[model samples]
Target: MKKNINITEEDRKIAAFAALAIVIHVLESSFPSPFPGIKPGLANIITLLVLFRYGWRFAAWVSLLRVTAGSLLLGTFMSPTFFLSLSGALASLLAMLLLWSSIRPWVGMAGISILASISHVMAQLLVAWWLFIPHRGILALTPILIATGIFFGLFNAIIASSIEKRLTDTV
Candidate 1:
């Protein structure tokens, strides 16, 4: 049985954005991290931009697609690493949804980004501790992870905002 699926312009936009994010994810994965579980998460900039421009739904699609596809490409699918990535992405998406629904007008990109990033790190750490490590020492990385989340979140926000401005100006 074959069913025809109608693809809308919005669907195309989401695919395009997701592809961009996937590329960034793959590239970032190739870089050497200073720590075992730390990266700048440059791909998240695309997710943040899509969120601000197209709304949370589109951003969610792009982000999830990026994680799934990137994991497959990296040969990490169905691995613990994949689960960790999915958990972090899901956590980040939830944070974005909460902010977008409740205090969107009051919060700016920086606040949203920081909160989402922190949520991502926390979710990953929890998953790692519960599923894999099962050690109290895993939680010891909390402070460092949170601090990096704040720094990278703000950094990504600044870049996202700049890109948004350019996009708006050109439009």
Candidate 2:
């Protein structure tokens, strides 16, 4: 007797989105950073759009898959980089899920994006402080990181909003 896996169209859709996120992640990794400890994270724009258009589960799957697969592609699996990526993604997903479930009616994509961005940045900073740097000096960078998070969060939301509008119009 054969068992059915119950893979539905939704699974395929999630896979496609995850693949896109993975590609963006890998491509972004190739870019030269102006300095260390700062990434604009444009790939997160895709995850935010998916979260609003689809659901938290799909977004979570795409995000984690992208982190794992992208790390493997970049040869950072099981490394410090991989842990940072995992931590950030998990934190972002948690923030999104909480906001989406509780205040979705009152919150727009911008709010979600901003909150998720903050959560991601904070998670990464904490992880770096705990696992990598482990110094009081690391706390000094919190303000800079928070400012960057706010800027990129708003920027990414604007882009995601336009992309969502276009996608909605085409469909």
> Largest TM-score belongs to which candidate?
1
Highest-scoring model, lDDT: 1
Off by over 4 Å in 2: 1-4, 169-171
Look at candidate 2 and tell me the lDDT of residue 94. 98
Q: Model 1, 20-116: lDDT tens per residue? A: 9999999999999979998888899999999999899999999999999999999999999999999999999999999999999999899999999
TM-score list, all predictions: 0.97, 0.94
List ranges where model 1 is wrong by over 4 Å. Answer: 168-171
- How do the residues 1-171 of candidate 2 rate in per-residue lDDT, one tens digit apiece? 999899888888888888888898999898898857778888899899889888999899999989999999999999999999899999999999999999889998889988899999899999999999999899898888888888889999999999898895332
The residue-level lDDT of candidate 2 at 121 comes to: 88
**For residue 40, what is the lDDT in candidate 2?**
82
Given candidate 2, what's the lDDT at residue 54? 86
